[model samples]
Target: MLTDVKRTPGEKAFDWLNLIIVLVITFIILYPLVFVLFASMSDPRKMFDSPLLFWPKGFNLDSYVTVFENKDIWMGYGNTVLYTTVGTFINIMMTVFGAYPLSRKRFYGKGLFTFLFTFTMFFGGGLIPSYLVNQQLGIVNTMWVLVLPGAISAFNLIIMRTYFQTQIPLELEESAYVDGCNDYRLLYKIVLPLSTPIIAVMVLFYGVGHWNSYFEAMIYMSDRGQYPLQLILREILIKNEFKDMLGIAVDSQYADRMIVREGLKYAVVVVSSLPLLILYPLLSKFFEKGILVGAIKG
Candidate 1:
């Protein structure tokens, strides 16, 4: 049977305080998103006239229409989807392969390998050297440059290794070996099936990283056609904002162009963030379990 417990006066006071704090924080986080959404839909003239945006002043879909009609935006969307999908796959595979071996106690020179990997977390050869190295590898200005150079992340590798060590039992592996299972068979059949939480977490991590990445695309790609969605959006924002500041117009109608330009900023933010926002909810249950289990020991 369930019993009701009475709280002390101090406890009750603390609960109310906590609730107030949480509400404040929630408002802080949600206000910007709400403001952006309303502003994007509002008429630009009204938006400029009003400092506060509790609701749309005058509803319009022109911003969304303009954004959707751009050829560069569509092309960039396709390229971003491809890059994020392929890059995340490679990231997960490389992280798993690197982590599995390092997690094994019997692996030779594991300490040395771990040290070398960890060293990278604190230090690097810097951008110039990295760019030079990529140039030497004949990957510069190529799609491979985006994926290959960052295939493995040291922090993610450590997390995976820790998860494998803590969650996977050595006795299970021994039992599998006795049943004539090889290393590859044990990994694929036994280990991976039981690692759904960690895998899901890794997928979310790598996928979001690849999706939001603009710096890599900008640095590596010279071809505008090959640019990712973020890069293209950045270009559009800069072009529009610059044109507005300089009183230049692609069209003779200056007022309409400015309205579209202002609204496009918020529209771009929403569109770019939409994929991850949708994705996180689907993986949230696994994400919680994965982070807790993976972080518990290490």
Candidate 2:
């Protein structure tokens, strides 16, 4: 039988204090997102006039209409999806292959190899040299340039190697070997099947990175058609070059342009970030478990 334990007065007070602090912090963190959302939906003139930006100041959605109507926006969206899916797949594959060998006890020169991987975390060829190399390889404007170069992240590899070491037992491997399973067979058939949580965590990490990446695309891709969603959105935000998106005539009133521009400003952010927000909740449990599993024994 379990007994209920009573909290001390101090403990109860501390709990209340923590609750208040959490609420305050939550409000602080969420307010900007809320503000942006409301601003995006609000009538620009009314939104500015409102004293407290708690709600939409007379709902408007011309900005969203402007964003969605752009063929380039759709093209960039497709490109971002392609890049994210391909890049995350490559990241997971490379990380798994790199990590698995290191995780095995029989692997040769593990420490030196691990050190070399870690060394890359600190030192890198600066941008100009990297660009020259990519240019020389003739992949400057290619999909391969974006996905292949960043295939394996050293930090993620270490986490996965540690997870494999701690989570999968030596007895399991020995038993598999006794059954005449080769290393590749053991990995493909048994280890991978059991590593879903870590894999999901890796997916979220790499997926988000690819989804949000813009600088690399901007640097490597001169072809506007090949530009990722983030790079396209950056152009929309910074350059305000949405005349092509505007359904109105070029001579349409400046006031109409301003209204659409105001909404588009926040709409772009919402469109870019909404997928990631949805993705996180779906992977949250797996992410928590995988990260803890890797860290506890690491």
Candidate 3:
């Protein structure tokens, strides 16, 4: 009963080629992640023996337990959650409001505003100047330093503006206007209803950026208690671990502990990555249509 599908020889050939290319690309991207999962689950000793890439040998959750036992790790987790959640909310608000006006052709000084936003995408005040500004504002060493300074990304604003202009129909806004719905009501009721996909994209982008950020915290926050997850992970994985990398001598008890702690590094990766990995599937569901709407539309 259904007969809309059609394919020519050339199309069939192209489809086969595309499928092969896609599978190859997927494997390339996933192989390292799969290796990390194996490394996390397998015995650290066994990992050194065969050096796994595809699967685990003697799977266990001990690494997870080790990661969770660290008080610093838990504190970092809590701080990261706070930063990511609050940052995403602020990002959405700023992006929506910033983009909405840009999308409106009737707005005065629209070109000037667009140019100003675009200018920031290419250049910024250097780290020293930015640090001084934060210090002057009294946000240095404070939690607000993490959330407020870089709340609205210019690229994300542009993407949202493009999405709003392309996907949300002008006639829908006109209809609302005729119904005596003001600009604010039209945006809150109508524009936002169709914007779930784009909003999800922004949330994923901003949330991941905020969660993984460490350098900002290292510069802005002098207090270890206020440090986000990535900064703590850096201290453990890179700074401490680097000292032992030149083959820690077997005679040193400290070296043995450092090697054991190396296993803990793998555990930390799995721990910090788990939240974003869980979030990715949900976020990916919104990406397909959102990318097309935001990118391909006139």
Candidate 4:
């Protein structure tokens, strides 16, 4: 049975204060997303006129239509899909392989290895040196540049190693060994079967990173044909290359490049972020448990 304890007047006041602060923070955080969504669907003229968008002042689908009809956006979307799929697969596989061994008590040089891995989380070869190395590797301007460098995130590796140690039963490993199961067999047939939650967490983490990444892609990938959706979106947003992207019809009331760009900007935000928003809810159930377990020890 659950019972509620009576609160003092001061405690009640603190609770109310906390609620107000949280509400204010929530509004601040959520307003931009809400405004962008409303502004994306709103008529460009009306969206421009309205300084505060509680909702769309005038409903319109022109921006969405313009976005959907663009060739570069479609090409970028295809490239982003390819990069995200392949990159996330590499991230999960590499993270799993790196972390699984570290989690085992019998692994040699774990202390030294763990120290080296953790050291990287704090320090790295600066951007110019990394770029030089990749240039020498001849992967610049290629899609592989996006996936290969960030294959194993040190922070995520530690979290997963902790999860494997804290969550998976040691007795299970011993039992598998007693049954003459090899390490690979035990991992494939036993450990992995029970690690769905952590794996789901890794997938979401890596998938979102790959989907939203642009800076590295912009630096490493110069070929326009190889650009990811985020890189294209960056060009559209920062360069205001709207005329080339949307090519708004002169006959339309909102054809003015300035007018179209406002709504178009929000639409691009929605399009770029839609996948991540959709992904979170699907993995929400696993995320809470997995992150907690993974982070508990490390």
- The TM-score values for the models, in the order shown, are 0.93, 0.94, 0.89, 0.92
**Candidate 3 clashing pairs, residues 3+ apart or interchain:** none
Rank candidates by lDDT, best first. 4, 2, 1, 3
Residue 133, model 4: lDDT of: 95
lDDT of 3 by residue, 220-265 (tens): 8889899899998998777774332333555657655654565678
lDDT of 2 by residue, 31-91 (tens): 9999888888888778667646898888988778878888888999999999999999989
Compared with the true structure, the alpha-carbon lDDT of candidate 2 equals: 0.89
Query: Model 3, stretches more than 4 Å misplaced?
Result: 1-21, 241-256
Which ten contiguous residues of candidate 1 have the minimum total lDDT?
241-250
lDDT of 4 at 246: 49
lDDT of 4 by residue, 1-298 (tens): 9998989999999999999999999999999999899999998888757599998878998889989989889999999999999999999999988999999999999999999999999999999999999999988899878999899999999989999999888898999999999988998898888888999999999999999899998788768998999989998889888776646566655457678788888998999899899999999999999999999983
- lDDT of candidate 2 at residue 133, scale 0 to 100: 92
Candidate maximizing TM-score: 2
lDDT of model 2, residue 84: 97
- Alpha carbon lDDT of residue 141, candidate 2? 94
In candidate 1, how many Å is residue 270 off?
1.1
How much RMSD separates candidate 3 from the native structure?
Answer: 3.6
Instruction: Kindly report which residue pairs in candidate 1 clash with one another.
Output: none
Error of 1 at 30 (Å): 1.9
Q: Over the stretch 6-50, how does candidate 1's per-residue lDDT look in tens digits?
A: 999999999999999999999999999899889888887788897
- What's the residue-level lDDT of 174 in candidate 1? 95
